[model samples]
Target: MKKYFRSGEIFIWFTGMGLGLSLIMITGLLFLIVVNGKDYFWASELVQITRTDGSKQLGEIVKEEPIPNLNLPDSLWNKGLMRMQMKIGNRDLYGFDFQWIDEREIKNTDLPKFASTIERIEFGNFYGFVKEILVDGDVKVKGEEEIAKKIGSYLDITSSIRNEIKDIEKSKIGKINYNIESLRLEIKKIEFRDKNSVKNKNEIARLESEIAKENRKYEMLKMKVDSLNLLASRYAVYCEDANGRGKTIPMINIVRVYQPNNMSFLEKLGFTLTKIREFIFDDPRESNTEGGVFPAIFGTVMMVLLMSIFTVPFGVLAALYLREYAKQGPLVRTVRIAVNNLAGVPSIVFGVFGLGFFIYFIGGTIDQLFFPERLPSPTWGTGGILWASLTLALLTMPVVIVATEEALTQIPRGMREAALALGATKWQVVRRVILPAATPGILTGLILAMARAAGEVAPLMITGVVKLAPSLPFDSYFPFFHLDRKFMHLGFHIYDVGFQSPNIEAAMPMVYTTTLLLILIVVLLNITAMIIRANLRKKYKSATF
Candidate 1:
């Protein structure tokens, strides 16, 4: 045993075991997320459950578990009592989407073929059986089969009209609103300069005339939308719940209707795929308990890219000065210690600093100087994408500096001396030889920085991240990349859906899905950086040697 210890094989084996255990734990976590989140998309069989009390409930059975003994009598403690959780998702009627029922109370259960799950625009989902389809208060389809077919047709028309309404509201009306705000700001600036000028008065009158014309146009558009909404509401689907309660849901409000109990394997698979696509591509709805997270994904990617762009050059330059140019002394060592210590500081501390320094000091100054017209109401004088990126850049700067310094140190002194001996200047040697050799190391630091930045939620929340952004930072507008805009983030989305959502049970699936996507994004970024570093290492290996 002493010989084995002295041979260092024990330590090697111990380290290997630790690494293997870590891999196993990571794999298990990923599997757990997949099990919980992936199944959310698959259409489960809806069961009509009849209880001993003669009450009926309809929903998909979500989970079953052994009953806990807490607050129970001794006689019931070890009786092996079980309970099943059901997703009875008629939130508007039931006031809740889930319910727990004891196994003993569930006297009868059946997979009802006619039961339908309707995905809606509000109040989560509706689980019921279609009774009839009504057009203009006239029964157009009465039987289940006929109602389903007619409902599908009406839904298609409603969807198209909804799309048109959304386009008009977000595009044409949005542009008009923006122009009116700009004109108002222009008038404010003119008033600030000289309130009595005839020229300014005429300009204000012209702006007022344009605003009135725009208001007329907006009213016309609003009327058109209201008419379409009324037309869409003319087609209604009457559905009856398990308890025999009837509700009339407008066809326009329903997103999709499916009979999970009757769906075949192929149909279920297709439904699951469609759901997954929507989760990835659609904007979140119902307070982020449903729909997709495309906006969050876009914001996360944009912020990380901006952070990388800002961090790399500054970190590389600081590292170069420390490693190559700075005199090795007590001051330099102290600075190195400070840099190392910054990495250990709580991330929230950085968030506070960002809020104060970036948003208040720098952003306020910019707003005061450049956007004087929009004063009091902040333009760049508040939390925004630019400040968030800069804040994260500052937070991750230490890691990049350390990695770059190490890379610079790895290049032999002999190489610099040889370059100098060959009549090359110090700058020439650095730009041509040292930099080329250290590209991989610089990228290593960048990969680490990006991975950290991508997952960070604390700093982003205070800096610029929002629950929902009205528009993306990049659009067809002039100066397309609006760095001053507050944006959504996947990390923040997970935080919000997991902890801040009104319905935790419904949000759990979204939390896992967003977590998975975030992990994939970070992995993808690191993989791309690693590939570049590998190629660069190969290119410079011979030259360095």
Candidate 2:
């Protein structure tokens, strides 16, 4: 036997081992997802309806158990149907016979009951059991869009409609008072004519008749006001209610919602499938429920969007000035140093700056000058999406500036000289030749900025990281982006679930799920950038430095 260690063989071997380890880790992740969350994909929670006698008992069927020896030989087995009785009031709701068959068992016969007075019966599957109970509610679950529309409708119709009705009632009461006053005058006028005369009696009767009519009108007006008030109250309640189906424990309903599929479905779709069903679709019972991640997601995305919209154009322009036009002076040198230093500032410092400058000072000025109606309560003068985005953009400015400058520096002097040599203007040379060549680098920088923004939790926490967002930032409504409204983030979700949740046991799985989802999103974004970079490289291969 001969042993030969070729050049770079050790490095290659190490690389291979590293890759194998990564694959093993990924496979382990997939296995966990399959074992825990696969059934959650195909299986929608089934609402167990237990209606016996005149009463209805509504609750989630948390779990089902099976009776032992129910599958034994016919001679040994108890000769009775093994039906699980659900206690719904005074009556028993039994599971349908032979419907709960295990795959391992061949027999489809009646199961044994422990007693005929039967308060309990076991229901189980032979292979394994499902721990996640089905949740049901009295009302049908709605999606984000539907819920937003409903919320907007309530805000629109209820508030204005109720106000109008209230005004109408007030007017009607005034009219009634006017009528009563007129009748009082009429009685006073008839007082001198006679104590019991026929003319006086007729006048008194006519006045009484007028007063009775006014009273009826007033009652009708009151009823109308009350009805409007009740409607307005209900709408407000529904807008706030997470699980609005019923008062009972959520009835597990087999709901079909478009959700973000986990790794398995993504694999099946060639890693292209972006969305799959999740428990988040279920109406949330509380702010911490899986259904409630909407707020955090919304907030996080909004913050990032706001940051990008502000940073990119501004950062690019500033970089262009420093690279293309600005004279080499102490002032320019100082500015460059400042920009570089800004990148190194702790993110928490930006959070503090945002709290003071964006949230309070600038926002307060805006609140005072423009939005007088929303004043005192401080519209812009609050920790909101707008300030958070602005703050993060300011924090990320140096990164963009540095990346753009480096990209510009890499552009060969020959490229610019050639463009000028062709009689092209300086602006044309920069725009057509320089910037286009640097687009990929610029995009790469932007992608890096986005990744950083997505993972940022500290600055956001101080600025506007809300646990639950009432609405999404961008919506179908006018000005669709509601920067004032609070939003959600995956980073924050992991933090809150892992640290803030009271029931760590229950929230542990959710923390994993959320962490996994965040990783998937970041990976997808980076992959997209890689694709873009590859395309750019192909297009500009000959235009080298």
Whole-model Cα lDDT per candidate?
A: 0.91, 0.60
Task: Show how many residue pairs clash in every candidate, following the order shown.
Answer: 0, 22
TM-score of each: 0.97, 0.56
lDDT of 2 by residue, 1-545 (tens): 12435566777889999999999999898677555433222321222232233222222122345546656566756544333322211111223212332223322222111001100111211111111221121233354444423433434554476447746854566557756866765675566446499878987998889888888988888888777665544431211111122211111111111212212444445312221433443223333633335555556656776788899888899999998999989999999999989988999999999999988899899987876544466767887888889988998888888888888888899999999999999999988999888877777777888888888889988887777665466665556667776567789878887789754433554676666667677777668877997798678767843
Clashing pairs in 1: none
lDDT of 1 by residue, 1-545 (tens): 99999999999999999999999999999998988887568898899999999999999888999988884578889888999999999999989989999888989899988899999999988999999888898888898877766677788888898888889999988888877877788888888788688998898888889888888888998898899888888888899999989999988888899898888999999999999899889988999889999999999999999999999999999999998899999999999999999999888889999999999999999989988877888998799999999999999999999999989988988899999999999899999989999989999999999999999999998999999999999987778999999999999999999999999998888899899999999999999999999999999888653
Question: How big is the RMSD of model 2?
Answer: 16.9
Query: Where does model 1 exceed 4 Å of error?
Result: none
